[model samples]
Target: MSQIIGNLSQIGGDYDALFCDLWGCLHNGKQPYPAAVSALQQFRRAGGRVCLMTNAPRPNQYVIAQLDRMGVPRDAWDLVVSSGDAAQDAMFAGAVGRKVWHIGTEKDDGFFTDIPGEWANAPAISRVSLEEAEGIVATGPFDEANEAPEDYRARLMMARERGLVLLCANPDVVVDMGETRIYCAGALAEFYEELGGQSLYFGKPHPPVYDRARRLMDLGDEARILAVGDGIRTDVKGAQQEGIDCLFVTGGLAAEAFGPDVEDPDEELLREWLATQQMAPRYSIGRLR
Candidate 1:
């Protein structure tokens, strides 16, 4: 059985660094949770480094701006690492190549910035349509709030026919945006895969993102690192696979399985849910507080 913690202080001294998930753990896209913010702030004040690791398909600066707008204190985290950053690294490393068809909103263009080369620097990314590109990069649906995977059926079919490999920046299927849940890029990638299109993910539950976070933290020893998040598939599983202990919060993303409202989940119910998912975090909490 997993121990339910009311405060993060119970295990704060056990870790030198924390790789914390952004959306579900800290805020729900609309605003920051006061308790969650205070918990991280408290942890950082205790000498532990807090790195906000997120699958958000935008650059770190965009997320920082959103956090600022939401009134989340700037001191809550020491660093921010995003999936878009990981995808850009993969793109420049010849993993996704230079010529690509970007299938996302205009806000996602930040991922295609210039990269320094050994010579006069490689040209900036050449954005082409599905018919002219060698690969496809998907951040999310063009209209996340109003579109679903079915909306991209025709587009995905065309890409599949052209044999364009997909590089997905965000691995989350759906995200809680304030009071509403919206589809994300991972949902589209799953549809593309079903259409026989090859896809690569650069976010959570994938080793590349975690590897990037570990390098950014530069904290030695995975044993001294604590992973915190709300999703079992992405956060808990990702941390466990990375050989780091995880702390799961029940009130976000996985709230449905925990309880009907944002209260402590039934211990046995949570245990059964984790058993079904084949995940057992080091600790479980209703919220980060």
Candidate 2:
């Protein structure tokens, strides 16, 4: 049973660090949440470490630039980790071959250009048509706001028939952009799997992202770590599998399921919903604060 908590301070002392999610928990993709920023700042002030663990399909540098633009304070977090880091490692190592079909808008092109220094001798990746590609690299939809998973049914069917593997950079299915929800790379991955295509996931609820984050968040006493995020499937499930306590932020994705008030999640509804999803977070919060 996940207990509904008022704030992060209640369990702050019990943990040594936090694996925090980005989008709905810290910001709505456009700006920073003042309360959420304060909560992380307070946690840092009390000698806790914060790693901004995100499923964003871009390198840590790109994410840092985004945070800066969003006005998320530098004091709020100690380090950053991303799903792109893990997926990029595998892609460069020839997990999906050298030639691939690229999905995602021009903003996500950094994923192709921003190769880490350590992988200097990695196989060069190139973008090609679906017919000439060795594999598929899907960051997200070319147009996230207006596109749906079914829109690529025929394309995915063609890729599936070719037996090309898809490397999913981000594993989040949907994200709330302020008040509007948009599909993410995970939706396309799900669709490909439904079409009998092979899709490899490297983000939350998968071990690759957690493994990379753990390596980056190296601490002497690494046992006490808390995961704070809104995605039940991505955040809570990932933390649970990693054997860490999670602070489920109900106000983000599942705000309506709890009740009318985003600040005060209905305990009965929260418990029932967690049971239905088969996830068990030790604690729950209406928001990150």
Candidate 3:
């Protein structure tokens, strides 16, 4: 474990660019954390460059628009990179003369619209259709309240029958959609894998997402970059895998994971949890704000 540092001011002097995480550290899926926003603004004003990185499945433009609505100004960070952006990059890389059956909301169609590919909507296609399709992209239409595991199972079975490769845009199983937890593309992908389907994931908790962020920031191997987020599985694990420092915000995924009784887990308890996981953030705080 790396030596944990408590001061935010120390971060400003040590790192060249910050690869910050969204969803948990910056906001709680409803509103932006005032303290966190102020800290980032202060960091930028003090000559630090911050690159906001998120696991949001939507394209960069959409993510930025959402953040803007959430009161997080675009100028808070030097750059923004999302899982959607990386998925789009991967699609473009292998999409020459290929047709894709995109299973996602209409908003996500924007990610593939201008790209060099054809789109199709088939819950299940025949082997002939599989021969026609180069790949299958699942973005998430599965709402836990409306769609069940059977629905995803049936769809994956159909895709497998046709021998189509699967690409999961959002690797998150669920996200805080206001007060409710809604299913993401990852949930469907996981079920598909259980049924003997091949799936590729692109997002945080996965190394590729951080790798792309590093490149975007022009960060070298030894560059000190802090990954601040709420979820231990995604933000914390992702930073640890990349060998970068991290700051875990308490009010996100681990809120209840820490315990329902304790609304605010102190720094010592947080440190104990990190020690148990073999992961330690350079710092830990109650909320991003």
The best candidate by lDDT is: 2
TM-score of each: 0.94, 0.98, 0.82
Name the 10 consecutive residues with the lowest summed lDDT in model 3. Answer: 119-128
Instruction: Report, for every candidate in turn, its global Cα lDDT versus the true structure.
Output: 0.85, 0.93, 0.71
Give the per-residue lDDT digits (tens) of candidate 1, residues 55-127. Answer: 9988788888888999999899999998887887777665656689887898887777534243126555778
| Predicted model with the maximum TM-score | 2
User: What are the per-model numbers of colliding residue pairs?
Assistant: 0, 0, 2
**Cα lDDT for residue 208, model 2?**
90
126-233: candidate 3 lDDT, tens digit per residue: 212434666777788635447645676666787788766787888877777667777777777788788888888788878777888778778778776878877677
Q: Tell me the lDDT of candidate 2.
A: 0.93
lDDT of 2 by residue, 135-251 (tens): 999999999989999999999999999999999999999999988999999999999999999999999989998887777777554469999999999999999998889999999
Candidate 1 contains a number of clashing pairs equal to 0
What is the model-wide C-alpha lDDT for candidate 1? 0.85
Off by over 4 Å in 1: 114-120
